[model samples]
Target chain A: MANVRLSSIKKSFGKTDVLHGISLDVASGEFISLLGASGCGKTTLLRIVAGLESVTAGGVEIEGVDVTRLPPEKRDIAMMFQSYALLPHLSVSENVRFPLRMRGIGSREEQAEKVAAALETVQLDHLADRRPRQLSGGQQQRVALARAIVSRPKVLLLDEPLSNLDARLREDMQVELIEIHQRLGLTTIFVTHDQEEALSLSDRIVLLNGGKIEQEGTPAEIYSQPETGFASNFIGSANLLPAEIIDGETGPVAKFSDGQTLQLALEVSARGPVTIALRQEDLSLDANGDGPKAKVRTRVFLGARNRYVLGLAGEPLRALTANDVEFSAGQSVGLSIDPQRIRVLPR
Target chain B: MNDRTESLLLALPGLLLLVLAFFMPIGQMLILSVSGPDGVTLSHFVRFLSDPFYLGILWRTVRLSLVITIICAAIGFPLAYIMARVGPKLRLWLVVMVILPLMTSVVVRTFGWMVLLSRSGMIPEMLRDMGLVGRSFALMQTEAAIVIGMVQVLLPFMTLSILGVITRIDGRLEEAARTMGCSFLQSFRTVVLPLALPGIVAGSLLCFTLSASSFVTPNLLGGTRIQVLAASIYKSVTQTPDWPFAAAQAVILFAGILLVLVPYIKMTGPKDG
Candidate 1:
């Protein structure tokens, strides 16, 4: 295992700049996730580290050696593609043995032994001789994972490898990925657009926006304390409301456009126009409660809970409440949230 | 009518064409091969098989066809791969270039090769000037001349068949191979060549069959001195006016082609289906 460090990497395709400049350092055995929306250049960053893409400027150092000029084959790294690009012509056992064969890791018999052990790791030992086409998507994904880790490369790169699985399969694979990381202790860089996947899998989540790092922190720290409006909005998909922060007798108060006011935490020092990010689950709805009032526009039944879309000062705000709480359209409902849960950012 | 009957009715014209335009001529040839002036006899077959000269012609035809097919595949595979990977506009232009010779008449194409392969032609003159050959070196009217002309004539068939298959191969497979520690060339060999085998086999079959039966290009480039089987058969029909002997040779050629094709079809056919 080795640490990977990317310093001031810039990439451009033709005249359009996709990655402005990105610098990140991942510790050995750390699982770092590059999470962003489509077109955010997270995959580009990962590819640069994998040596699949050349950097326009800057250097990539792995294990303190500058490998920016090296091709992917020369670098001691293995990557798993999102498509689970198993060679169709090779059987499952051969697919898992590809890296070992290419890297010239061991003798033929030793490679066979390792292949069997890797297949056993993925619970695919019974289907070793079957071609990739004969396996299902999840099985193919396991084979890809086995192929990636079989060689015990210094760094493992995964490009949204779990996005192709269904919900249940994705969850099971997520748990398995965590276990594999813990067992192998390989320095892994996973690229994904799913915030939940990044949250659950990575030791540090680097949220990117518009080809720049928007925020970087542990999942819990980034989730509870998103610093910017975009970070707050992107991480938890928090609803943003335009308001003015005013110093009140007790603490800071946020006044919306329609003259409704909500109390903020005492530690908030922001003044003037600001956007308060309220998470969906943090907001509470009550029919006979003393709090800021809003008119309910619609309520969607989500089986375990109901998500109420409410109109607050001509803006739509959504809140998740218990399914037992019933409210009709056009009904005026009280919206309350913990003062400390609101994230205040400059508008 | 029901679906099966309707489909059969729709296919009746094609089926009739196959029976009349294809099987009728083959049936006539088969009958003629066994017929003689006095009675049905195996004498012509026995005579052709026993003659060392005729046997040499048969062996030369098979040998030249195999060489041509192998050469076409060796060149066509990489050319098809390049065409598949290039941009569409460039690929279209390349496809046109590869197919241009096929659009011309075989006679015209053979004449073009004759101009280049003859003693006074551009190729031999260049070779002589470069001191690569002796003054007596000549390419025309030789097996090399036949192989070269046949390859140019049949390269399009080989290239296009492989291109059709290579274009469908997922490029990501190569990228995955690269990340799995394979160099680009290694990946092309291990992943691409195996995947493209069906196309190569198909193209080889086509090249072999076409070159084996082709008369004009081989007869022209090879001259009368270096006669292939098809030219011999043509001589028996046109020069000697021996219809039964020609029919017998044609049947042998047809049978030889099927001998090479049946096992090939069995090997690759079921996998695709």
Candidate 2:
């Protein structure tokens, strides 16, 4: 496994810049995720690391060696594409053996042995001779994984590899991905738009917004201490409400526009106007409570919980309450939350 | 009265047209190939096969056609791949460029080649100026001239046929190959070439057949000194007024092409192989 570094990387397509001078460092054997919405340059960054794309201005170093000018074949890396670009002409075994063959990794027998072992790792040993077209989607994904890992490249790049699968299959593949990473400890850079997938899969999530790094931290740290409005909203579906921070008798409290106030946790050192980020799941709804009274605008019936859209001071805020505690549309309810759960970001 | 009969009845016009327009000429050729001054005989076929001059012409025709088809394919594959991958505007321009030669008359195109390839033409002049050849060197009235003219005319057919298939191929396959550690050229060979084989085979069939049967370019460029099988057949029918011998030679050419084409068609069957 190897660490990958990108310093001041910039990419432009005919006057419009996609990646605007972004820099990142991936630690060795660490699962780092570049998480962003579509068209945010996460996939482009992954492609640049794989050498599939040229860097407009920057250096790409892998394992402490500068490889900005090297072609993909010369780089000691493997990338699993979103489409699972298995060679349709080659059988599964041959597809797995391609990198080994191209890199001249081992003897014929040795390559075959590695191919067999890699296939076994993906639990696809029985499909050795079958063509990729003959396999199912999940099986093809496994074959692609097998092909990527067969050579044991220093860095593994995955570009939304699980985004194509169905929900259940995606979950299964996620588990498989975690298991494989744990077993091999490959320095993997996964590019995905799904926040939950990034949070669940990566050791560190680098949140990208408009070709720039918005935040970078562990999942819990990012979820709990999102520094910007974008990060808070994108990461944990935090409801943002403009509010002013005022010093109370004990500590600072965030006062919403409607005169209702939520006491801030001791750690938030903000005095001026700020945006209060309260997660949908973190806020509790009760008909009888001493808190901000909001009218239930809508109630969506989820399997295990009811999501109630509340109108708070003329702004819409959503909350997830347990299914047992039912709330009807247009009903007045008090929205309460643990002050520690509130994330205060400077406006 | 029933669905089967109704379907057959609906197909009757097409079947009759095939019989009348296609099979009738072939049947007459088959009969005429054996007919003699007195009665039906094998004299015409036997005579053509026995003559060294005729055999040489036949061999030259097949060899030149093979060379032309190979050259067309060698250039067409990459050209078609590029045309397939490029943007729509660029691809349209490339397609038009490839087919422009075909839009002109074959005789006109051949004369253009004659102007470029003659001793005093630009090609030979450049060669002489570059010290690549002697002052007496010429490219006209030769098999090479025939092959060149034929390849130039047939290249569009080969390229278009392959382009139709290559464009339909999943482009992601090539990207996949690249991520699998394949160089661009390696990806072309391992991914694009195999997927485009059906089109290649089809284009080859068209190139070979059209090159084999065409007489205008070869007749104009190769002149009387060099005669291909089609030119020879024209000589038999028009110059000598030997209808039976021409029919026999035509039958031989047709049968030889079919002999190669039948197995090729079988190879291009619906099975994956």
Candidate 3:
């Protein structure tokens, strides 16, 4: 395993910048996820580390060796493409052994053994002789994973590899991925857009937006305590409302534009206009209660849970409630959230 | 009408045309090939097979065809691969450039080569200037001339067939190979080449058959001495007035192509397992 350090990587296509002076360091044997929506430069950053793309201005050092100018083949890194990218002409075993065979890692017998072991890790040893085309989508993904790890590369780069599978298969593969990473201890860089996958997989999540790192922290730190409105919005898709924080003699109270006041955490220091982020699960809905009143727009049934869309202080809000607790549309409902759960950010 | 009868009725005109225009002439050719002075005989076949001169013509035809096909493949594969990988607009231009020779008349294209390859032509003149060949060295009227001419005439067929296949190959395969420690050339050889075999096989079949049966290019460029099978067949019919002999040579050429193709097709053909 190797530690990768990307220093101020800037990537651009013509005049449009994709990654603007972004720097990151991944320690040895650490799993780092570059998480963002499409076109957020997550894949480009991963490609730069893998040597698949040249940085416009940056230095990539792996194992303390400056490999900025090296090609992917010389970097000793294996990447599993989102498409699986298995060689259709090769059988499953041969596909798994491709990296080993290409890099001349071991003798024929040794390579064969390693390939078999890799396939076994993915529970696909039975289909070893089958061509990639003959296998199902999930099976092909496993073959790709096997090929990636067979070489025992210094680093493994995965580009949204699990996104192509169905939900059940994606969960299975994610669990498999965690087990494989723990067992092998390979320095892995996973690029994905799925927030849940990033939360479950990465040792640290680097959220990207507009070609720059928006936030980078542990999942709990990034999720529960978002530093910016974008972080709150992108992470849990929390509701954001423009509000004013005024020193209301006791501590701080948030005054909504529609003139509804809500208590804030006592230790809060900010005393100007700000944005309030409320997690959907944090808000409690009632027919009548001691909180700001909201008009129920709709209630969506989600089998195990109910999601209520509400208009609060002229802004739309969503709150998750137990399936048994419900409210009809256009009805006035009181919405209450604990002051501790509210995230106040500068407007 | 029922489905089968309806299909047959729809195909009736084509079937009638095939019977009258294709099968009848072939039947007449078969009868003519076997006809002797009085009765059906094998003299024409035996006579052609026994003659060393006729055997030499057949050898030259097969050899030149193989050489032409191999050359076309060697050039066409890389060109087609480049065309496949390039952007759509550039690929379109490359396809047009590759097909430009085919768009021209074969006689015109052959004459263009003749002008360049003749003793006093620009190519030989440049060779003289560069001190690469002797003053007496000429490119025209040789096996090399025929091979060159035929390669040009058939490269489009080879390139287009291969291009159709290469473009369908997922480019991500090569990128994945690279990350797996394969150099660009290694990836092309190990992954791209094997996947493109169907196209290569198809192109080789086209180039070989077309070059083998070629008459104008070889006849015009290789001159009278270097007689390929098709030119020999033409000579038999028009020059010698040997209808049976020409028919026998045509049959031999057909059999020769089949003999080469059957094993080739079997070797590269799709496998079930």
Per-candidate fnat, comma-separated: 0.83, 0.62, 0.93
Residue-level lDDT for B257 in candidate 2: 94
Model 3 chain B weakest 10-residue run by lDDT = B264-273
Model 2 steric clash pairs? none
- For residue B85, model 1's alpha carbon misses the true position, in angstroms, by 1.0
Alpha carbon deviation, residue B250, candidate 2 (Å): 1.3
Clashing pairs in 1: none
DockQ of predicted model 2: 0.59
Each candidate structure's TM-score, on Cα atoms with residue i matched to residue i, is 0.97, 0.95, 0.98
The top-ranked prediction according to DockQ is 3
Q: Every model's Cα RMSD, please? A: 1.5, 2.1, 1.5
**Residue A199 shift from truth in candidate 3, angstroms:** 0.7
Model 1 chain B scores worst on lDDT over the 10 consecutive residues at B264-273
- The residue-by-residue lDDT of candidate 3 on B115-204, one tens digit each, is 999999999899999999888999999999999899999999999999999999999899988998899999999999999999999999
In angstroms, give how far residue B2 of model 1 lies from its true place.
1.1
For residues A1-347, write the lDDT of model 1, one tens digit per residue.
Answer: 34898889899999989988888999999999999999999988888888889999988999999999998898999999999989988889999999999989999999999999988888999999998998899999999999999999889999999999999999999999999999989999999989999999999999999888999999998999998888888888899999999987788999999998999999998899999999999999989877789999998999999999999999899999999999999999988899989999888
Q: Which residue pairs in candidate 3 collide?
A: none
Local distance difference test scores for all models: 0.93, 0.91, 0.92
Q: Measure candidate 1: CA RMSD.
A: 1.5
User: Compared with the true structure, what per-residue lDDT tens digits does model 2 show for residues A250-273?
Assistant: 698888888888888877788989
